[model samples]
Target: MNVDQIILQSVIAHRLDTIAQEMGAALERSSRSPIFAEACDFACGVCDHKGELVSQLNGIPILAAAGSFSVQAVLEKYTGNIQEGDVFIVNDPYRGGNHLPDIGIITPVFHQGELVFFTVSRAHHGDIGGSVAGSYNTRATEIFQEGIRIPPIKLAVKNSIIDEVLDLITYNTRNPQMLKSDLYAQIGANKIGQDRLRTLLDKYGLKKVKESIIQLLQQAEDLTKAEISKFPAGSYTGEEWLDDDGFQETPVKIKAEVTYEVNQVTIDFTGSDKQVTGFVNSSLVTTKSAAYIALLWTLSPEIPRNSGAFRPIKIIAPPGTVVNPAESAPVTLSTLHCASEIISAIFKACAKAVPEKIPAGFGRYCGPSFYGIDPRNQKFYVGFAFCCLGSGGGKKEQDGFPYMAPISNYGGVRAPNNEANEVQYPLLTLNHHLEVDTAGAGEYRGAPGIKYQVQFYGPDPSIVMFGDGMKIAPYGLGGGKEGSLNRNQLFTKESGNEWLKSKTAPRSLQPGDILTLFSSGGGGWGNPFKRNPQLVYEDYKNGYISRESALKEYGVVLTTKGIDWNETKKYRGIDYESRYNV
Candidate 1:
């Protein structure tokens, strides 16, 4: 390529990024759900006519990566050729992406009446019609119960809305008004991206813009391969367990076998448990999107993530397994539950290959927990409330971020205020704070857990809590102790009532019933004995750990002002086991 070609490619790439940002801003401004506007639980990307990702917003990582496939699925399934002003929408987990709640819309851009590019936007609506209020039932046995599935259909064609499709969606969902408004917001975002892409194509010519996408993809592929080659040429295997499959009381396993050869790496999920009769089953596209993100984080954190970064990596998951279930399998909580285990296994594989480069495992999975119900007004009000929890940190790094949403990191940034929650639903969020001493102890302590309380104002009979990770805690790295397990409890103003049975049972709540959620903390990294005394003292002073627990778990002696290093070492070195053989 000549100098002019390089310059033109760079300019086009920058313009596409700008287009993505504009689409994202429009979505945020127009969305009715706080998760989209405040939490930014959405993604916007520009794609070539072939449905390859060109650029994306810096919003939710997993959403941005997985949403690309939704657009491509539409392009492949549509019978008629895509023309200018053509728009398509789909949310079928079996056909394309994660679940039915995340609706995606694709618009084909035109330059001089020629189809030049496409723009796609996806957002998680508040509710999709299902057996459960939140559309995600922890104990759901089949996909039919999850939500309404919509295949590729023209939401808007030539700027004219499709009334039939809109009517079908509205009829199926409990919140038709909110869904309709959010659907238009998604369409509006895609339109903004389409306009921006057309403007860029007109200035640079379609040939140059297309050439830039190819160049951009090639650059990402090269950088990714270079990073993979740096690791040792070998295969590594790791496994993690969910507390139970919501049906059986025993633990179920998910395993990963990662092979790093030449410039490419493949993750094979064999020996994983058969797909459970629950929402734990993850779709193949969702699995690959997660693995790709973890590999990028481990190998090339700075490289732009588009279609290019994944050209060198392959993901293999046998059908019927947990990672790649059949089309009928349910996957509403893939982001919260199964996806975390997949990422944890991949990161563990990378840590084994490059220990210094990787930190120990932070508690990867949390917040498939759903808590809420439908008020008498027929207005669907629900909450995926336990999303705020810390992850276990690696040795070199502090415990993973506290109350941070795993895989996506969408929950941590400024949360929706209590007033917003009250305004939207008939529920009151009384408390949302960090759980004390939830982080496991080590040289580098894990992040603390989160605690939240929700009280229902109106009569809503069914409220489910899909909390997992009870029996098997989030494991630690480098000989560190595993983090604490999660806890869920029910309290009421009335004198006595037996607690609901297990993680799967839906709580039948009265108007004044109060629910408390204690999210688990991440595990520590390295030996606690080696943790700096000053840091230990700081932890106690900062209210992260109690003084007594620190002395017992970390063997640090607390003085009036801070830790006494010499005294701490003397007590830490003492073998209490020798004195008391109990």
Candidate 2:
């Protein structure tokens, strides 16, 4: 190709990426749900006519990577019926969806009557009603109890909204008006994508744009392969476990065997545990998306995450395993686990190959979704306590960020703003501050856990507790100490304060009931004794660690003036000459 063609190719790629980003921005600003508008728990993507992902703006990493699957499902179902101005929606895990709560809206972009591209948006709603008030029904045994499932269907035809379909979906969810408004926001976001993509095509012409996309795809494939070849040829295995399957007393495992040969790689989940009776199962597409993001994290940051980026990496998720469950299985909490265990497992499996790139275990998501009648407005309100979100794992060069949604989110889903949340819900935020001494001890300390309390003032709200990191804390790596376990408790005037389960069906709450959430700290990386004593002293000064922890965990003796290096050396069992070496 000539220089002009190369320049045009770069322009086309960035234009498509910008279009998807615009879609994301639109959704965040217009969506009604706090998770969508405030937390930004959504993803947007632009796809080729064939449903091959071209460019996806990163929102939620797992959700962004899985957008292509939803588009492909729509294409397969609609076939020739797909036309200009028509929009499609799907949220059935069996039919290329992440889960029930994450609904996807797809729109076809046509230029002068010929289909050219697809715009897609997938977002997690606040509530998709099921057996319980919140969607994370731990007692649910089947998908039916998880929530309402919407298969690949036309949400709009020829730019005309289908009122009955909208009514049916909103009718089932607890927050009908919120759901309806959020759905419309998704529709509007996709519409923006369609318009922007059409503008790009008009400027560059269809023929050149098609050539550019082909070159872009090939470029991504070549870049990804180049990165894969860097890994040493070997078959490495790693395993992770959930606290339990919500119902079982024993933990459930998700194992990974990663193989790197030449420029190709394969991830197999042959020996993972079977599907459980709880809602922790991962859908096939969700599994693939999780693996894809894990690989992307270790690969060259420049590699475009288009369809071709995954050409050299093949995923084998065994049927009926926790990685790929049956159609009827409940899978409401799969997204949360992607960061906690699945992605962590893959990172561990490839640690020997990419030691510098892989990070330690992230604090798993262990929050609750609560709903009740708002006495202030005489209406029902549903809210996600993302304030219970944990911190990130430690990296080689940097400490993990505090109070992140999950590792799977990659900072896309930020912690809910306290003031914004209070305005949206009928709850008072009592505390949202970091808890000192909760970070795992290592060369680079893991992020510290936090204390979050919310006192509900409405009548009899139900709280559905789901997620891990309670019984089993985030795992440490490279001789580092493990992070502290998560703790959930309910406080009331009658019942003083009682511990809550990691996974339970549903519990009713009285007015003025305070929910206290103590989230898990991120796992640390490397040995603690090797950490810089001065840095440890700084941590003590900043109140991140107590004086006792500085001495016990880091073997650092804090003095009135500065660190007592002589005492530190004695505590670490190393002489003055050898103190810095280890």
Candidate 3:
């Protein structure tokens, strides 16, 4: 291509990306729920008339990829009926959706009376008519018990809202006002994207704009292929285990074998365990989304994300497996823990090919769901709190960030603020802080986890805990120590304190009762003795590690006069390497 054409294509690509970003901004600003506005658990993107992703905003990568599948479903079902000013919504897991709560809205745009493109928005509703208030039923054995499942249906037609369809959705949710407002926000964002795309079409004309999009997609494909070709062709395998399926004591295994060939990479879950009778089974959509997230992280950031970029990557998980469960399997909790395990397995497999590029294991969701009637207002409240805790594994030169979302969602979901929690619900925060000696010991130490206690202030509330890494701690690499295990407890005024089951069924919490959670830390990298002593002293002075742990774990000696250089040398000894086989 000539320089002028190349410049034009770049401009068009930037415009498309800008439109997606604006859609996300609209959703965040207009949504009513803290999960969407504060936690930012939403995604926006644009696709061609053929339902191929062209550009996407920065949010949850897993949710962003859902747009293509959702759009394709709508187009196929409503082939000749699609018209301007029409919007369709879908959240059926069997119909190209992650789960029931993550509803997606698709709106098509036409240029000069011809179908051209589509704009899509997706967000997680806090509650969607489930047996449990929080829509995370740990004991649910089927999808029907999880929540309402909406197939692809028209939400608006000819620029007019469909009151019947809207009412049906709102009536099924616990918080109708919040759900209605969020749905409108999603629709409003798509309208904004529609207008922007039309403006671009007007400026560049249909033919030229279409040509630019084709060229842009090709550029992304070429860039991604070049990056994939850099890895040496080989087969690598990784395995991970879940504590339980919330129904049995036996652990469930997830095994992944990644094969890299010339300019292509394929991940197969053929050896994964069979589907379980719990809510942890993952659907095909969630499995593919998790694999996409893993590959996206491995590729260079310069490569533009579009359908073309994924053409060279393949994911396979046989039907009835935990990773690709049957349609009847409950999958409400799939994306939370199972998705993280999938990503962890992929990273473990890739470590053999590119050790420096992968970090150690990070903790997944280890939080509580509280739902009850507030005596003060006589109103019901449901809260899902996935609070901050430990850091991820250390990188080649830097330590993983602590208290961030797991690799699956990354920074898209934020932990609720302590002050906000007290004001929004009938609860009181007793204590919240970082736990010391919880980080995995290595050359670069893993991030430490958190400890927090909450007490019920009003009537008794129902509480359910969801997470993993309780029995098996986050794994460490290169001889690093494993991170601490997750712990949960109940402190009742009548019965004293007792350990609560990791994946506990919902139960009542009397007033004045306290719940405590200790989230797991991230895995560490390399050997602990190789860590810098000065950094160890800093960790000691900052109270992240005790002097006793320092002495035993890193062979460091400390006194009132600070670090004892001679004593430290003697503690480490000259033959430390040979003694420990470091």
How would you encode candidate 1's per-residue C-alpha lDDT over 73-188 as one tens digit per residue? 88788736776667788888887777777788888887887766778887787678887766767667788888888888787777988899898987787768878998889998
**Residue-wise C-alpha lDDT for candidate 3, range 297-355, written one tens digit per residue:** 77678888788887888988999999998887899877776888888889889887888
TM-score of each: 0.92, 0.97, 0.96
Candidate 2 C-alpha lDDT tens digits along 1-582: 999988989888888989999999999999877888888899999989888899998788889999989989998888899988788989999998998999999999998888999999999998888988768888999999988999999989879999999899889988799899999999999999998988898998999999999889999999989988887889989898889987888988989999988888899989999999888899998899999988777787899998989888899998999999988998888988743578878888988677778777777888788888887788888788887788887878887778876787767887778888888888889999989999988888888898999998778877888888888887777877788789999998898999988886788888889999999888788898888887898888888899999999989999889888778878887775665554
Cα-lDDT of candidate 1: 0.74
How much is the lDDT of residue 202 in candidate 2?
90
lDDT of 2 at 346: 89
Residue 556 error for model 3, in Å? Answer: 2.3
Backbone atom clashes (below 3 Å) for every candidate? 8, 0, 1
How well does model 3 score by local distance difference test? Answer: 0.85
Model 2 TM-score, all chains together: 0.97
Cα displacement (angstroms), candidate 1, residue 47, comes to: 1.5
Candidate 2's displacement at residue 532, Å, is: 0.8
Highest TM-score scorer: 2
Model 1 error, position 79 (Å): 6.1
Where in model 2 is the C-alpha error above 4 Å?
573-582
